[model samples]
Target: MELFGTEGYVNVSVKKICDEAGLTQRYFYESFPDRVNLLAAVYQHCVDIARSATIAAATEVIDRAGVADGPVPAAVIPILAEEALGGFINSLVEDPRRARVILIEVVGVAPEIEKLRLGAIHDWADLIAGFASNGRPTTPKQKLAAIGLVGAITQLLVDWQMALTDPINEQAGPDLFQVDSVHEVVTEMFVATYDKIFG
Candidate 1:
């Protein structure tokens, strides 16, 4: 992760990775067939951490709000959304190398990697959709909207990490990388859109 995070996939070498791990190339080869394989493993690990944390955050909200016996409380939706978003955002912020590897460096790396990325996106979208609908069946429009929202958020974070969000380039007036402002805006947008889709 550190190697790929620092030098990126194209620039990273097996020697560097092994050196960083204080292991032999033989050991790396024993575990991973190639660099892409190593990248896949790292990506999967990071995704698992992120997914688990986000789910835990949502579960905490559900437990705290005491929504086990009935439909999720309407007021709890924003809290859940915020908590889930915070979990995901903090995980990336805590280890931006993982974020760059998953969000930026993995782009166009391999068909399998791209497929994995899309699959992860859809998995997250499914979770958001289910939560938005309060476990009710989602309409086609709602499902599509959920997917779109996921895509938007992913791109937003990607741009933020890549320094693509400058004041002149964005119509939002300020750089979107301002973490707190971005978090607040994203939460508001998500809550509003989720309600519109499922309310």
Candidate 2:
């Protein structure tokens, strides 16, 4: 995972991975058939981390709102969005290697890998849709709105990551790296979409 994040999956070889882990090729093959398999595993691991963080953060907000066992009020939607999205974003920002593997390295790796990535995105969208509906069955429109919100957040993170890599973005200021800024933007998007869909 670290290697894929720092050196990139395309550049890293099985030999390097084995060397880093002090394992022989025979042992490595025992676990994974090829490097692509390993990359998929690593990507899943990163997604799990981010997903867990998002859920946990949102749960905390719900608990604090005294709505753990009840429907979440519409008024709390913005705060929920801020903390939930912040959790997902901070989990990656705190570890750029994970961020790279997720947002950059995982792109166009292979058909199977891309499928896995898209599945993860849908999983996140489903999660948000559940939150919006308070665990009720979501309508197709709600699901679509949730997916759109997730896509927007994903693009925002991609752009933020790009700015971090480009020297010219340095002049854009520290807001690029601030989780608060990201949370605010995402929260507004979520709130507006929620109003349109569920009001």
Candidate 3:
């Protein structure tokens, strides 16, 4: 994961990976058929981390609000959205390697990997739609909206990650990297979508 995140999947060799892990090629092959399989596992790990972080953050908010059993109150939705989005974004921002693997390295891989990536996106959409619907069965429109929102958020984060590497964006200052700004924008977008779909 570290090698893929830092050196990129295309650039890193299996020998290098084995050297990094102090493992033999035999051992590596025992676990994964090839580098792509390892990349898939790493990608899935990153996705799980982000999803777990988001759920944990939202659960904390809900627990604190004392609304564990019932639907989350509409009044707390914005705060919930902010914390949840922050958790998701911060998981990546705090680990640039993970961010690069997820947002950059994972793109245009093999067809199977692409399918896995799409499945991850739909899983995220299901999660967001579930939250927006407050555990209710999401309508097709709600599911579609959630998928669109997830795509937008993914692209926004990718742009943000790119800006971090682009020297021209340096003048944009520290605020550009602040997770709060990203969270605010996404939270507003999410809340508005929630209102449109479930208000």
* Tens-digit lDDT string for candidate 1 (69-148): 66787788899889988888888888888788778888889999999889988898899888888878888898888888
The alpha-carbon deviation from the true structure for residue 33 of candidate 3, after best TM-score superposition, in angstroms, is 0.6
Compared with the true structure, what per-residue lDDT tens digits does model 3 show for residues 31-66?
999988999999999999999999999999999999
Backbone clash count for every predicted candidate, in the order shown: 0, 0, 0
- Against the reference, the lDDT scores of all candidates come to 0.82, 0.88, 0.87
Q: Estimate each model's TM-score.
A: 0.90, 0.93, 0.93
Q: Which candidate would rank higher by lDDT, 2 or 3?
A: 2
Put down candidate 2 lDDT per residue, 71-131, tens digits, no spaces: 8998898899888988998899899999999998889999999999999889999999989
Worst 10 residues of 1 by lDDT: 165-174
TM-score, structure 2 vs. true: 0.93
